[model samples]
Target: MVGATEEARLNQLETQVDNGGGEAWEYLCLVRKLKARRSEKVLRHGIFILNSHIARSKLGGEEWTLYEQVAVAAMDCHRNDIANDCIEALSKKFPGSIRVGRLKGMLLEAKGAWPDAEKIYAQLLVDNPLDQIILKRKVAIAKAQGNLAAAVEYLNNYLETFMADHDAWRELAELYISIQMYKQAAFCYEELILSQPTIPLYHLAYADVLYTMGGLENLQAAKKYYASTINLTGGKNTRALYGICLSSVAINQLTKGRNKDEKDSADLQPLAAEALLKDYKERAPEKLALVTAMLRNIKLVS
Candidate 1:
């Protein structure tokens, strides 16, 4: 379901069109701003504006941008005919354009023509060796072909040139995790945390990787990162709360009969358990009993 804010914005865009306003560019931009998954709506409104002489007349230079936008939306909606029309128009206007070539490659990709799309992207790369979009498209092609190893290689090469791309780092991290390369995933998350230290998601992901690695030292480190995640999210993250409990239990087991100073802070487990119980009580009262029993089994609660 759409949120109130999104629904309101969608309604406003519809009203602008219904009133016959020449705000075609504004409408296109607003629709594009909506989530990319709203392809049907984008295609619906885009076709209307593209076909309307009044709207097209008012767009001027933005008409080309609308064509590109509608072309992408059409591909997403599996309307290849519309996408072809837009791409043809763009190709006529901007002959031998690399951007239009990329759209052509994407259309081929949508059609499941792997080798044809690869050829297009390869040629585009030869024209501009450092083209980031084409590089990412290479990775996407590998992924679409179910060649995850190739995807990883392509992404790693992309990162060698653009190390500061946090989104790329995150994508690589997820790829690593999917392939059961936890240590490599941990390294990627480390890069992400160093680049954007304030993001709780990276902290949480790092903690998860560390906890999965499971040694005495790793568990201890995972507890610290989970605590960091909890702090970053203002203690609202239930997964981090559970991480605290799990890692603390593991650490306690590993340090049994060790010196007190070598053990985790005694209050950490109890505090996390308390917070978890309170959260469940307020948010899922029925599940509270199950949570209490689980905590009791782990000796975090009586």
Candidate 2:
């Protein structure tokens, strides 16, 4: 079932169509926008819109765009026959077109034809080596085949040419984490933090990686990043709050019997502990005892 917002939007689109006020291009554009937003109803609506007489009459120059859109929607919906028909139509209209070729490649990918998809993407790359889309396709193919190392290699090479791609950097960081390469993951998150300083996700991820790499220095660093995450999120991030408590406890344990200067920000533990207890007391009363017990076990509370 579609959510309330999606149901409302679908109703509005249908009302426009019924009243003859919806232009084919406008309908298609709206459907494409919904698809980009990951609306679950888009596949059915997209296919229906493409087949409507209104769409047929109005998509004179936008015909190929509608075909591509429906092709992708059909592929996602597992309607391979519809996808094939759309791809064939596009191939005939725009012969030797890289965009059409990429669609064909994606179609093969949906059908699990890994080798054939790779070949098509390879040829497309040769035609345009700087194609970011084709490079990402190669990474997807590697991941689909469960070849993490190959995926990493492809992404690293892609980053060599396109270092500013934050999405690619995040993907690389996740791939590194999956393979237990925390140091490499930390490096990727650092790059992401440098590129997008205001994003709390990068700060949180960097803190987690530093915590995983566990040492006095890394524990201290993780505590700092976790605190940054809390600040960026205005203390709404439960994970960041927990991260502060954990990292602070670890740092205090590591710095035991050391100079006061060596203790770092171990003083933040009680504040974090208080925030956590207060959050649980107000929002999750049922879990308050469990949280309190946990805080006590970690020596963050009495």
Candidate 3:
């Protein structure tokens, strides 16, 4: 986040704490929260708050959720320089504590610094082999970097390590769709559905790939999936499910080249396309539009 000098200063503070040190972060916490300048004096409190959270986080040989929260706060407040500086400094100060590496990695990954994030995560894995959190982060980095084979491999490992890994299966399914490996993606969704079918997005995602690959025969299955998803999701997310259903219906129309409305074949395509776009927008915040567009493109105009 910050340049060399600030990172060094933060490291020094953490080192003092590590060596049977002081309540520096606490003392600064009481400082005046007045001006918003980058001076060492003003930034010290922020640094202290950041480190205090980190110190509290390192109590056990465990995951440091508090430090993760602190780092996230720094990033969310556009204080990445402070967060990064804090992370780098703490790593040196508390070399025995994996909290520094883990929290820093979490912050970096959240901010889209996948390469650097992956490096930190790799270090954490070496320290704690059974850390499901780091394993998930590794899968995420592989998936985002388009290393689908790697993602698939790591997820398989995650399964062996964690039996109750519902989210891991969900992420695996999503990655399959991301790489356009529809059939495999569908299977992944099916596996997750076995555990948690109530999430509407999972059903929608499953229906999408089925529709993409199976043509007309798949439409019936897709519709069925959408219906189940609707029932499971309930009215709380009704609009979102409706949006996904509309997109699925639009895809079916493309494959069939006509709607259930037998009256106008030529007029159907553009209308279907428009409905797909509308539903996608109404789906609260998701990548349904991108998925819809991709499905729309894999067609034969004949």
Number of the top candidate by lDDT? 1
TM-score sort, best first = 1, 2, 3
Model 2 lDDT per residue over 1-89, tens place: 24678657756875776576655356557666554443234455556666787856666877678788878878878888988999999
CA lDDT, every model vs. true structure: 0.89, 0.85, 0.61
Worst 10-residue lDDT window, candidate 2? 35-44
Candidate 2 Cα misplacement greater than 4 A, ranges: 1-40, 257-259, 262-264
As for TM-score, the candidate ahead, 1 or 3, is 1
lDDT for model 3, on a 0 to 1 scale? 0.61
Please list all clashing residue pairs in model 2, or write none if there are none. none
Residue-wise C-alpha lDDT for candidate 1, range 10-41, written one tens digit per residue: 66876776577646466668666764355776
Error of 2 at 279 (Å): 1.7
Q: Please report the candidate that would top TM-score against the real structure.
A: 1
How high is the lDDT of residue 202 in model 3? Answer: 80
Give the TM-score of each candidate: 0.90, 0.88, 0.53
Clashes of 3: 2
Model 1 clash pairs?
Answer: none
By lDDT, the candidates rank as 1, 2, 3
Question: What does the lDDT read for residue 172 in candidate 1?
Answer: 97
